[model samples]
Target: MIGRLNHVAIAVPDLDAACAQYRGALGAVVGAPQDEPDHGVTVVFVELPNTKIEFLYPLGDNSPITGFLEKNPAGGIHHICYEVDDIMAARDRLQAEGARVLGSGEPKIGAHGKLVLFLHPKDFNGCLIELEEA
Candidate 1:
C-alpha cells in the first residue's frame, strides 16, 4: 500500500526558469539538477517543510517529458509519488486489483536512488502515480 506523499513532479519546458521561480520567487531551497537517463529527465528538487517538489525537464528528444510538453506546451503536473514499504507487494496487490502498471511493471531507481514504479495515468483518474520504496 502507499505511504506518505513522496513528491509531486511537474513537467517544465525550461528547467532554469522553473528553478528560478521556485528558488528566487518562492524562496525555496532548490537542490542541484540531476540527469536521470533511465527516466529521460533532468530534475531539480525543491525541498520544503513537509514534502518536496520535483521539476522535470526533457533530457533527450525521445524523453517522455518531451511528449508531455507537446501535449501541454506550458507544462504541468506530471505525476505524484507516494512511498511504499514494499514495492513488489504493492505492485502485486495493485495488479490483482486491476490497476495497470506502466513500463515493464518493475521498479527502477528514482531520483532519490530508491526503487520506483509508475502506474498508468488512466488507472489513476488521469493522473500519473509513482510508487517509491520507503
Candidate 2:
C-alpha cells in the first residue's frame, strides 16, 4: 500500500525560472536539475522539511511534459508521488480496483533512482499519481 508522500511534481514552462524562484525567492534548498530520459523530463527538486517539490520540464519535443505544457502553457501540478512498500503488489491491487496504470504498467527508475510507476490521472480524480517503491 501507500506510504509517505514522496513528492509533489509540478510541470514548468521554464525549469530554470522555477528553480530560481524556489532558491532565490523562497530560499528553499533546491537540488541540481537531472534529466530523466525514460520519463522524458528534466527535473529539479526543492527539498522541504517534510517532503519535496519536483519541478519538471520537457526533455524533448516528444516528451510527455511537452504535451502537458501545450495543454497548460503556464504549467501546473503534474503529479503527486507516494511511496509504497511493494510496487507490484500495489499495482496489482489498484488494477483489481479498475485503476489504470500509465505506460507499460511496469516500474521505471525515478528521479530518486527508485522504482516508480504512474497511474492514470482519470483514475485518481484527475490528479496523476506516482507510486515509488520505498
Candidate 3:
C-alpha cells in the first residue's frame, strides 16, 4: 500500500532558526517557505540525497502545528509521510484492516502539490503517518 518514504515532517516553534540550522550548520539545501493555508502550516523542505526533511510551523491560530508545538515546545518529528501508488486504494485497504483515517477520509493537496491523507497515529504505533500519492 505504501511506497517509498516521502519525507519526515518536524514541527518547529521557530521556523527561521530551524531553516538556518539546516542551511548554515548542516549545509543543507533548504527550500523557500511555502504557506499551505488549507493545512495551516508554513513548510520549508530541506533537500537531501535520500529523502527530504519538512519543517512545519503554524500558519494560523488554529493550525495543527500550533497544538503540536504547545505540547512539544522544542518541536519534534510530527509525522512520517509515505508514498502510495493509488491513494484511494491504500485508504480502502487500511480502512478494511481497521485503521482510522484522519480528517474527512478524503485526500488533500499536500506541500508537494500531490494528493495526501493522514492516518491516526495510535494505529501506527503512536507515530503519525501520512500517505501521499506517488
Candidate 4:
C-alpha cells in the first residue's frame, strides 16, 4: 500500500528566503518552485538522499498553510508524504482499515506531479499523512 517516504513538507512564510537558506546553509539543491493553485500553496523541493524536503507557503489567506503557520508561529512540519503505486486502491484499503480522509475520496494533483490524498492526523498517530501515487 505504501512505497516510500517521498518528502516531508514544512510550512514557511517566505518561500524564496527559505529556499535560499536551505541552499546556502545546507548545500541543498532546490528544485524549481511550483504553485499548486488548487491546494492554494506554492512549494519548493530540496532533493535529499532518502527523501526530499518541501517548503510550503500559502497563496492566499484562505490557504490551509496560512492557518498552519499561524498556529505554529515559527512554521513546522506540514505532513509526511508516502509514495504509493495505486492511489485508489490505497484509499480503499486505508478507509477499510478505518483511516479518516481529509478531502473527497479522490486523489488530487500534488507536488512533483503526483496524485495525492491526505489522511487525517487523528488516524495516523498525530502526523498528517499524505499518500502520493506517481
Candidate 5:
C-alpha cells in the first residue's frame, strides 16, 4: 500500500532556471541533479517540508518527457509519486482494483536511486500516479 506522498514531479523546459525559480520563490535548494539515460531525462530535486519537488526536462527529442511537454505546453505537474513499503504488493493490489500499469513488470531504478513504477493515467482518473520504494 501507499505510505506517504514522496514527491510531486513537474515538467519544465529548463532545469537551471526552474531550480533558480524554486530557490528564489520558496527557498528550496537543489539537492542533486541526476541524469536518467533510460528514461531520457535529467532531473533536479528540491527538498521540501515533508516531501520534495522534482523538476524534469527531456535529455533529447526522443525522450518521453519531451512528448509530455509537447502535449502540455505549460509544463505542469507530471506525476505524484507516493512512497510504498512493498512495490510489488502495492502494484498487485492496484491491478486487482482495475488500475493499469505503464510498464510490463517490476519496479525500475529512478531518480535518487529509488525503485519506481508508474500507474497509467487512465486508471487514476487522468492523474499520473507513481509508486516508489524508499
Candidate 6:
C-alpha cells in the first residue's frame, strides 16, 4: 500500500525563523513558502538528499496548524507522509484493514500537486499519517 516516505511535516509557530534555521544555520536548500489553502497551511520544503522536511505554519485563523500550535506552543512533528502507487487502492486496503481515513475519504491536491489523503493519528500510534500518490 504505502511506498517510500514522502516527507515529514513539522508545525512551527514562526515560519521565518524555522526557514532561517534550516537555510542559514543548517545550510539546507529551502524552498519558497507555498500556501495550501485546502490544507490551511503555508509550507516551506527543505530539500535533502533522500527526503524532504516540510515546515507548516497556519495560513488563517481557522487553519489546522493554528490549533496544533495552540496545543503545542513550541510546535512539533505534525505528520509523516508516505507515497502510494495508487491512492484509491491504498485507501481501500487501509480501510478494509480497519484504519480510519480523515476528511471525506477522497484525495486532495497536496503541496507537490499530487493526490493526498490523511489518516487518523490514533490508528497510527499517535502520529498522523499522510498518503500521497506517487
Q: lDDT for every model?
A: 0.92, 0.92, 0.94, 0.88, 0.85, 0.93
Candidate 4 lDDT by residue in tens digits, 27-132: 9989888888777888888999888998998986589898898899888999999989999999999999998888787888776677889999988999999999
Tens digits of per-residue lDDT, candidate 3, 17-68, equal 9999999999999999999888899999999999999999999778989888
How well is each residue in 21-127 modelled by candidate 6, as lDDT tens digits? 99998999999999988778899999999999999999976898888898999999999999999999999999999999999999988878999999999999998
| lDDT value, residue 38 of candidate 1 | 78
> What lDDT is reached at residue 85 by model 4?
93
Tell me the tens digit of each residue's lDDT in model 1 across 75-97. 99999999999999999999999
TM-score for each model: 0.95, 0.93, 0.96, 0.92, 0.91, 0.95
Question: What is the descending TM-score order?
Answer: 3, 6, 1, 2, 4, 5
Identify the runs in model 4 with alpha carbons over 4 angstroms from their true place: none
For lDDT, the strongest prediction is 3
Q: What lDDT is obtained when candidate 6 is compared to the true structure?
A: 0.93
Per-residue error for 73 in candidate 3, Å, reads: 0.3
- Give candidate 1's TM-score: 0.95
The C-alpha RMSD of each candidate to the native structure, in angstroms, is 1.0, 1.2, 0.9, 1.3, 1.5, 1.0
As for model 6, its CA RMSD to the true structure in angstroms is 1.0
**Ranking of candidates on lDDT, top first:** 3, 6, 1, 2, 4, 5
lDDT tens digits, residue span 72-127, model 2: 99999989999999999999999999999999998988878899999998888999
Query: Candidate 3 at 47: error in angstroms?
Result: 0.2
The superposed Cα distance between candidate 4 and the true structure at residue 84, in angstroms, equals 1.0
